[model samples]
Target: MEWGRCSEKELKDLEAIVGAENLSTGESALGLVSRDESYYTPKIPPQVVVMPASAEEISAILKIANPRRIPVTARGAGTSIEGNPVPLFGGIVVDMQRFDSIIEIRPEDFITVVEAGVGYKDLNKALGRHGLFFPPDPGAAATIGGMIGNNASGVRTIKYGATKDYVLRMTVVLANGKIMEIGSLATKSSSGYDLARLFVGSEGTLGIVTQATLRLAGIPAHHSAAVATFPTLQAAAQAVFDIMRWGFSPTALEVLTADLVQMLNRDRGLGLREEHTLFLEFQGASEIALEEELGAVQDLCQEAGALSFQPGLGIDERNKLWEARYETYESIKHTHPGADPFVADVAVPISRYPEILEYTAEIIRDHGVTGYPFGHAGDGNLHVVFMGDASDEEEWGRIVRANEAIVSRALELGGTCTGEHGVGIGKQPFMEREHGASLGLMREIKSLLDPQGILNPGKVFP
Candidate 1:
């Protein structure tokens, strides 16, 4: 598809809609929105960047761009690991930063209305006062809009679920500059199509979310954490499968390779055991219940050949432990300075968790690549960050091959190419393999919603 260049008249019209201050054709602004946290290089910079403060402003901007076939990519905090927010066609990028506002918090109703650009941490900090919080952690300080676009989830997803589960309603600005609101506040709906959910993981390909009403979860009355070390990565992975199989529900269950643990220790002063480890957290209403659950988990880990089981951490220690876990990606990056990360995010059935972990290890070993394999093990999600200098074609070729091998194995094991990270550019090759004929239906929906193909052009479809 040929994309139109933003002429001076179009630029002035957009500026008039959002004011000169909110719109920019500056090189720095275009550069900032041109790329995300992904390793993908920015090939073409956007022609203009506009920070639309309200839904109406976004609608007006879309109205101007949609008819002209100018690509409009919505950007939030720009923290996506995949290039989900990258403007590949070099048109107009709608920066959602100005939409950061917590509209309302109805604690009694267990819901919060917020603009798309509110930071995840900032929203939770405000919710903590009311004994409530949003569950999809996603690690980074990502904006609500970005999370919705990618359906982002993190360690907490094992129990609470992803961003899609929490999203109830959203005010979206469609490609034709029409303001559309989808979803209901009711807990259960027997109503028509679930359009709200349709847009949740669309990655701004369908529409741009300006505001969202999310379902809030109450804070647990009690919390407990434990650390279990195993002699092998497979052992820890097996324990994760067993814990899930035997009906042990953990708030967060993470498995880390020894190399990753060492990196965390060196980078964050964590001082954790430099062995394959499983980090587990349980939330309950009573201390006795938590103790019983921890004891059962210990037995499962022991049966899987655990070297040590340390349970019952204090609040301070628990906070510190999770903080370290949340910074795993950063820790890996810091360990290999000047190297880019090619992260493989895949998920399989719980029973196939151990097999995938073992297979990933073999691929890394055979390729002789520096890879840190770790992830939300309880949910059968595996992440391996292959670090290498992108400029070195031979070395990076090995990394690419290793990634492909792992993803192919995951597909063979009834898994997906990406568990959390959306398909921006990196995983586009696997979309057909993973989705099969259903992918054709997805394309149909995209075409129906965005006939002009102006919304987030050159993404999702292979």
Candidate 2:
């Protein structure tokens, strides 16, 4: 649907609601707002951008836009790779950057209250003082609102869970300019509806999150990191399956391919083994207990054909050891300049993890595409990145085919097309396949919440 663009009068009214300096229609600002990290091409810049500092301001802006049937997309730092924040239809883009403020940090309650624009790094800094943290580390630049919107999670998810699990309550502005407060700070609730969860991963289509109350975890007293090398990806995946089934929980368990390791060493000068490696971390009651757990994991790895086990016990060592996993995307881009990169993640049952990896490897090999396969193995989620020259349209098609094959197989194995990253436009094809008839119910809910369909149009669905 073609959304109506904001006219001079509408833009002026938006400026009135959030000040002239807080609103922009400039080409440069629009250009920056038009694109995200997604592969979807030729940015569709918004007609205007409004930076609201509060939910009331957002409601005012929406009140103006809703009547005119203008598309309003909520965005934070625009770090979403799924094109979640990109304005596909030109209209008003709600920039939530000014809404950043740590409203409260209740150490005793193990909850934090922050505005939508609060970034993960800043939240972590505040939580550090209290020796607590929001465990779901989605990405470096993700905001709390963005994380909650996408229900983002990462390696830390092995033990804690996703952004959805930590989101206790949120202040949301519905599509029709009505504000609604959902959820409670209570440890558990038998309330009317778990409304907070409905919007957690809605990708901003349902509502604009203005504030969030997140559940935090205490910093482990004893922590250690390790990397166990294996001759093959199959063996590493096997070890991961065994470790998870053995009732041992890892703070983070990552699987990196040999090629990715080589690229990391060449680009970052981290001399990691150029073989499939299982990166593991332990956190527990005491140093002695942590060591014992590590030993048990070491035994499992050895049984699964681990080549060597290396430990990173100190602070610096632990950080550096995990750096290899963190530097993956940059390494891929650096090693092959001008290659268009497409990253996709899928999660499966722990038992099927190894077969899926092996099958994905075959698909990449058959297509002759440079694929980087890595991710949180403990959670049975894997991310594979395919890179090829931008000018090579045929290779792009090949990559798309690879994505289709992997996602389809993942579904067949009772897995999701996206493990952490929310479905923006890229994964829309598999939505029906994954959710089946439930897709209709989801659409109904979206319609009920956003009757005019003005909020974040052209997302989470075709």
Question: What's each prediction's TM-score?
Answer: 0.98, 0.98
RMSD of each: 1.0, 1.2
Q: Which stretches of candidate 1 lie over 4 Å from their true place?
A: none
All models: lDDT? 0.92, 0.88
Candidate 1 to truth, TM: 0.98
Candidate 2 on 1-462: residue-level lDDT in tens?
A: 556777888888898999989988899988888877876633456788888898999999989888889999998888787788888887888988998899999999999999999998899999999999888886558898899888999988989999888888889999888999899998688988899999999999999999998889999898998889999889999999999899999999999988888888888877887899888998988999888899999999999999999865687777876765776787788788877788988999889999899999999999888899998899989899888865678888898899899999999999998998889988899999999999999999999999899988889986
Question: CA lDDT of 374 in candidate 2?
Answer: 91
Candidate 1 lDDT tens digits, 1-462 = 678888999999999999999998889878888889887755666899999899999999988898889889999999887788999888899999999899999999999999999998999999999999999999988999999999999999999999999999999999998999899998678799999999988999999999999999999999999999999888998899889989989999999999888888889888888999999999998999999999999999999999999999999888998999988888888888899988889999989998999999999999999999999998889999899998899999999999999999999999999999999888999999999999999999999999999898888888
- What would the C-alpha RMSD of candidate 1 be, to one decimal place? 1.0
Where does candidate 2 clash, by residue pair?
Answer: none
